[model samples]
Target: MRTSRVDTTIFGATSLLTLALGGVAPEQITVPAPVASEDAEAVAGLWLSADKTVRLRLDADWSYLGRVAGRHRAAKGTYRPEGTGLVLRDDTGLRTPVTIADDVLEMAGHHLFRA
Candidate 1:
């Protein structure tokens, strides 16, 4: 498993940027996480909707925004999967709890914004 320190740029809810390790330019245009393996491979992509909602894509980059009508509405932070939940770091660097199961995510704070 490659646990190297990668450059992760956190954009607010309005814009999004792709992140990659070392010099390996992001092959895809979305943020990915490790799935069914110890190594961080491209599993799924995440993004916001036109109405400011959070959405997750499988095996592809974010295509468009989502509708804003969820618990994570107007949220912003750095998201990383941890076991059965996602670790969401808000703009203030505060760690918020987020649970992801069956392709649906539940959050305790507003963290559905883009990266």
Candidate 2:
């Protein structure tokens, strides 16, 4: 007599159910920690939103200036790489997180692209 074995797999919220059902053990997963950008020059430049309503200028001195509607000042601050992104410290002491991916910068729910 021959016997066959069935294999089952589950993901997300169902992983526990798989274990309870005596299915194959789920593999241990590991995620890497985010690291700050090493080369500041690489990200230094002018970036603008798709609709042209927002703009950000990243300078070589690590200082930044933001504008809305092309001329109205929205924010003036300094920026530095922090954990896979940048932390913009405004002159008023407000801090905002900006994520840099490719040629795009995401901050405060807005996406800015290199100009």
TM-score of 2: 0.66
Candidate 1 TM-score to native: 0.34
lDDT of each: 0.45, 0.81
* Per-residue accuracy of model 2 over 22-84 as CA lDDT, tens digit each: 775444433324544556687889999999888899897889998888565589989888877
lDDT by residue (26-106, candidate 1, tens digit) is 553344343433322333456433345445332232122223465554445445657655565656677755554444455
What TM-scores do the predictions have?
Answer: 0.34, 0.66
lDDT of 1 at 94: 70
Candidate 1 yields a Cα-based lDDT of 0.45
Off by over 4 Å in 1: 1-43, 46-74, 109-115
